[model samples]
Target chain A: MAPPSEEPTDGAVSPADYRTLCDLLRERTGLSFTEAKRYYVQRRLAERVEATRMPSVRDYLNLLRFQASGAEMQLLVNLMTVNETYFFREKYQLDCLVNGMLDEVVRHRRPGERVRLWSAGCATGEEPYSIAITLLERWPRVDEFQIELYASDIDSMALDRAREGVYGERSLQALPAELVERYFRPVAPGSWRIIDELRESVDFSLVNIVDPAQVRRFTGIDVVFCRNLLIYFDDLGRRNAAAMFHEALSPGGFVALGHSESMSRMSSLFVPRRFPDAILYQKPAEGAGA
Target chain B: MGLVKAGSKGTLGTAPTGAAAPEDWTALLEHADAGHRRHAAQALGDRPDAAATLAARLPREPDPAVREALLTALVRIGSPEAAAGLAPMLASEDAGLRNGALESLQQMPVDAVEPQMDALAGSDDSDLRIFAVLLAARLGPAERSARLHQALERDPHVNVGLTAAEAVAELGDPAALPALEAFAARFPDDPCVAYTVDAARRRFRGAS
Candidate 1:
């Protein structure tokens, strides 16, 4: 076997290799690398090329095509996705979710009806746990209603961190003191582990949002927190994801996006509703029909 | 014309190697399986001649994944016809498609995409104009300054003007200073527009 080159022949992916990897990455996951990220992707994946002992990016791509077992494919997915998230990263949006979204849903909910919420791209579990904390604290009778909270990410490693529910102090910066005290127990120096019941309330899974079939499994969800996820997708990916969110939501359910994202630009399926503190999308309530 | 058949081991290389007739690859787009269509679509990017053929097939393309592949091919074709076909997609209801088309157009050579600009900038639609101004800012300093100037002065849409001001701030064009001042003066109380204009002025002035 040819020894792995200390450096890529050109220290970059060839144009063809870039295209091939991009196509596969976009297909397997909704995540896309912008032109600016192309060079970054090349440098990041160079180690994989070395570890796999491929001669060039082309060779590595060829392996992905003809010979990759699921492990190699998963490795590529893990390398390309950006999973930077923290507890309460965007507190204003969470505020909207707790104060406005849940408030409206609770008022309209039928007796014993569980309020279902999904945190798509819930990297490292910060988002979902944050949601659970927000619900538990804000909803006066939250325990009285059955609550189904699902959190998913394409990165299995991140999901593992999320599953463990242990977080460093950095993830707690935006979290209010009261919520932290109430919801977590000290685990180590400057670290906290979520209380067991709070952690158990959320169901975490590996989900690629671009896969229509996988997304189809979720239906009648009352709220979806898919913030900061769609910004990376290309237009086609964004459109498809929006359609999927539309399909997954129950009538009159809400979808909250990152501050910079807007569903109006992509699809008419959701109506833009401005809350006192934030803007969100709501699937239209069903009409009186069969 | 070059062609790539995704995953054909016999033809596999850094790029899809092995010269197949262009017709053969284009023909594969008609196949029922999404994977085949995706492969063919990715392979045909270098064929500007295929733009019209690909654009025609876009609407009926049921699968979003296949549609994405087709859009990528058109953007790569970078022909005038391809740019024209791509314009409508910038306004697609899907944020992904809108962003994809916008990014693809931004990446295309200025000369190649210039043909589609007039229709976008001159249109009555504010969204398209906003998109056009954002795109123009990426076309290098001179062109960006020029478009930003006209957008601030002449674009009827306030949102478009506001977007232009933001792009000006991002580019920090010294030449745009006068326009930025005028724009800020035009909307003194409109905090959103004023913020971008003031920011651009500060950026350009600081650079000077």
Candidate 2:
């Protein structure tokens, strides 16, 4: 093996090393990195060189490709994945979820049949908690109807944060003042602790959305908020994720996308349905009303 | 990447001198010489609707000095259109262009920041992505945490990653701890990397 260059262009990852790393990242996670992201990839993997005690990027690539166990690869995934989220993000969509989508699900389900809302890519629990807050606020009689809120993200650390249910003031900005007052108690200055009631409502898990077997585990979901997620996925991953959502949702169940995202280019499994100011895709129902 | 450089000049030395009509300024903006275009850009600064024309010319402007002047004009115009125009400069290889764009973006209204930063944050250019992370850090805590986290995770540039590690030090988001630790581990010999990671670890752990 060639000896590592002591002076590797002052933080520049060698081109060959970068390509090897990109291939591994793409194969493992379906993340597409461009030349623009080359520096970022090099930097993220550089961290691994020290943590894993690998001699160089080349050795680290070798370990990731041929030697390291699942735990080690998982550590790399943890380092490289993006997890940006906050409570009540994109309120217009939340408004549609509570006022329109859930109402439709409520009307169709048999008595005592619960509604399950799955927040895919629910970074740090904000999206799932936002769903719970919406249900509690808009559907005060939330108990009357069975409700199960399942939130999953590939990032384990984010899942832990979701479980803790503590948020800084910045997270609460988009949230209505009254909702903040009612649903959260100030745990520290500028930080609000989500009440147990809201915390307990969400079932947080570490599940990769693109994994068919993993996504298959989520079944009969009434609504899936996979917002801001597919944007990170390449075409194959996005299509697979779409197919998984289609299979996971019961007929007539809805899926919401981030404002900048769209299903028009990816799938035909769900039809776009417009709400007051937002749009959600809905699976077609099988049987007509008697 | 090609870099552009030019001698810096002070802002339009004197008040506009009631220079020609908006239409004349618009035409002069395309004049062959850099000075004529610079003055035209300065003259159009007060006309909000002229933003589109100004924004359109920025990316193609060959002169760094005029580009800087146009950037200043955009800042003075201070419209969403102007802010949108500045986004292309963030991806420029020229340090002056990027800095000028960032300087104007910093002064933009809160609502204008996201649209300007959004394209760059998602840009295929590493330079823009790095600037996006830095810009996000300056926006607010929420934006800082969000953009820096994304930059730390997905950016391929070492400088961008290192910059992100340092920026996240202020937010103290524990989610950054693993990445920071990884960074420290990767560049154990680099004191700057170690210090950044250690400080971030302390802050994030303390926050938790």
Instruction: Please tell me the interface RMSD, in Å, for model 2.
Output: 29.2
Native-to-model Cα distance after best TM-score fit, residue B163 in candidate 2, in Å: 45
Question: Which numbered prediction scores highest in lDDT against the true structure?
Answer: 1
Instruction: Please give the clash total of every predicted structure, in order.
Output: 10, 14
Task: For candidate 1, give the lDDT of residue B128.
Answer: 92
Against the true structure, what is every candidate's RMSD? 11.0, 23.6
Candidate 1: residue B66 lDDT (0-100) = 64
- TM-score of each model, in listed order: 0.63, 0.55
Candidate 2 chain A: worst 10 consecutive residues by lDDT? A281-290
* Regions more than 4 Å wrong, model 2: A1-9, A287-290, B1-208
Poorly placed runs, candidate 1 (over 4 Å): A1-10, A67-69, A176-178, A287-290, B1-208
Ten residues in sequence with the least summed lDDT for candidate 2 chain B:
B1-10
TM-score of 1: 0.63
Scoring each candidate complex against the real one, what DockQ results? 0.05, 0.01
